[model samples]
Target: MPVHRPGTARREHHAAGVLLAVLSALALLLTLPGAAQSADGENVPPRGSARMGQGVLEHDGQGGEPRGGDAVQTEGVDVSSHQGNVNWSALWSSGVRWAYVKATEATSYRNPYFAQQYNGSYNIGMIRGTYHFATPDTSSGAAQANYFVDNGGAWSRDGKTLPGALDIEWNPYGAACFGKSPSAMVSWIRDFLTTYKARTGRDAVIYTATSWWKQCTGNYSGFGSTNPLWIARYDVSPGELPAGWGFHTMWQYTSSGPIVGDHNKFNGAYDRIQALANG
Candidate 1:
């Protein structure tokens, strides 16, 4: 039997410790979630940053002023339901330049609201339009995409069909029908985007909450350079954006805006999409 030298063993152990430290730091950087406060510190991911009655002054990045010699023109909303009423003409004249409708959800579920709104209003006019897929674990990526396209009217060959969007967010707790890991969720999104683009020739747009952007989908390697981001952040002020995304085409900042013909207000954002695409 050969005996190992004590000094040599210590050197080997030290080298292994250093390698582990590097790996740990890299993982922490990659998987870091948002530092936003949660209700009871539990996970309650909202489409935007959790307001949770904080009385925080969530700023609208494009409204209230002009900056750097450019007028803020992008504005729009997402409407799947409106207090049990469908108001089409009112939405068009309200200066809503873009609208995103919920098309399909995961687990073989479809958004009845989307059909009601899209068909009810004849698909809100003039501005851009897109459909969002609620990715759940129960269905495969391609199946989920197919359900959305079938139900959301993506196959109509209508001139108004905009790019598809993947709504990647944390669902209500205990909905594990979708994969739990962020990478897995991103993989599903990428697969759906790939198939959708191959069929339709339209690349996908990614929609996610601020926390989820920071934690899960922010650094997803599956997305390519051409994908646009639709980020939702209810911040006191829209300061510097998150570090990872080089370009964000739209920012959904406020959920308290009035729309004619609807008693309850809706949420929306400023569309820098043209600038994003042009650039």
Candidate 2:
């Protein structure tokens, strides 16, 4: 759910072929943004999975690059089928405590690897959730949300389950705001959240970057409390929250995190995330 503001997508990330070669050649170190440094100077490797942002994660072939971090206290990763086969054991060993696997995008495309990635993360003792890439322009938000829930967004009070996330970021295609006016965008988003809440008995997490939110939804502020915010911003300090949010629930710190896709963290400590997982 990262913004596509130059260097945000395109040449940087993809599932196969040339982009991976470029990333590997760069030999970039992997770590979550603002993750605590290790006192023992231990090295952490990037998790081998595909991450979908402005694009998707690289195909797994290379080993993890060294980065500065001890064990992440409450780190998470999001992945789509593009990530290929995930080494969940390796990911857990690297301190990932939760995962959000891509389930459905818009109303039609289901991730080919949804069951494997979703069940894979849970089997490894990670709190697991699913997300949907929203396409407001294609249909009503409720339509897409229902499609997502039917596919994979359904949740139980399973101790290790997390609420579904609504990945309403930059439209990969079409107008920047997904072709809707600001007010229409806001209405569409609310429709999705409301529908998701009714279905899940819990509010869905809203994933978006600050600027994209502002531009698309006129910086709408109505959802601050009902829907927890999952802010995605890479390579910079956490910026102002989306309109009306007094605090953030989750922060996607980097796409180049210890694993593929987007690397993220809860705003609080392990205990808090533990509380989330148990619920």
Candidate 3:
């Protein structure tokens, strides 16, 4: 879970084209909101994925344009999928105010570089920092929380990291890896969050993609209002935010960007995010 607060559905019909069109439109709107919105008030992107906003990342085919810190805003990215092979100094030089590093996955797997990279960055002073877990399909929210607490080296003397996150994305593990049900998932997540809160004495945050929420966990209603949300919607811009979430702290709007000294491309976001994070 993330500090920012971060939903949808379908009918019983054979509408593959319609579904693709809808998702495509949404992606376009999300990736290119400025281009799509016109004087006629008609968005060019498809349906379900529209609402792109500024700060959305872009790729230039061969490579991406490097974007770092400016007097204008904060910059950050998701390093969960990214192996610990990043150049921390490049990001620091690029004006990275925060970092959401992937620390653990469920109970068995851990980010090989979490311990080294997390502490490495913290020691060097990278503003605020946090960790997110790669949730597994099986129900083991407590174990996941424990993994983060135990291994996530970055934390305040009080216990929790400056912020903590739950990276709940679509189950890419196939059908068997499918969810246990929205309610069950919510229960599991709540359990993990509560466990973390008890240990750290801070509210846990949830990070998720927009489509996952819309189709799967949009209606989840058990958590308290204090929980924050961190959402990921890669569109043309960072437009149309989710409504169900009462609070949101961060928005991961881009997936590709130019950062200093990194072997591969990276992601970035707007500078005004500190306001959104309330930091």
Q: Provide the overall lDDT of each model, using Cα atoms, as 2-decimal numbers.
A: 0.53, 0.75, 0.53
When summed lDDT is taken over every stretch of 10 residues in candidate 2, the lowest stretch is: 55-64
TM-score of each: 0.61, 0.74, 0.62
Q: Which stretches of candidate 3 lie over 4 Å from their true place?
A: 1-73, 157-161, 221-224, 260-279
User: What digit string (tens of lDDT, one per residue) describes model 3 on residues 1-279?
Assistant: 744322112342447668888999887765663445534554443211211111122211122333443424356655643544667777778766566666666676566666556665555555344555444565477777877788672246422135677766654333312456766666777788888887777677676655555455555655537666676655433334444565446656555556621121112244333332343
Superposed on all Cα atoms, the candidates' RMSDs to the truth, in angstroms, are 15.7, 16.0, 17.8
Candidate 1 wrongly placed segments (more than 4 Å): 1-71, 120-124, 153-159, 175-179, 221-224, 236-244, 260-279
Cα lDDT tens digits for candidate 2, 1-279: 956797557555554658677787555443452222343544322222213455222211122332434534467898887776788898899888888998888777788888889989999998889988887888899998899899999888868888899988765444557789999999999899899988888889898888788788888889997888887766344568888899878877676665566687777767776676555
TM-score of 3: 0.62
Indicate the residue-level lDDT of 6 in model 1.
69
lDDT of 2: 0.75
| Residue range 78-162, candidate 1, lDDT tens digits | 6553323556667667765555656656535455565556554555553344455454556677876776666662532454445
Q: Which one is best on lDDT?
A: 2
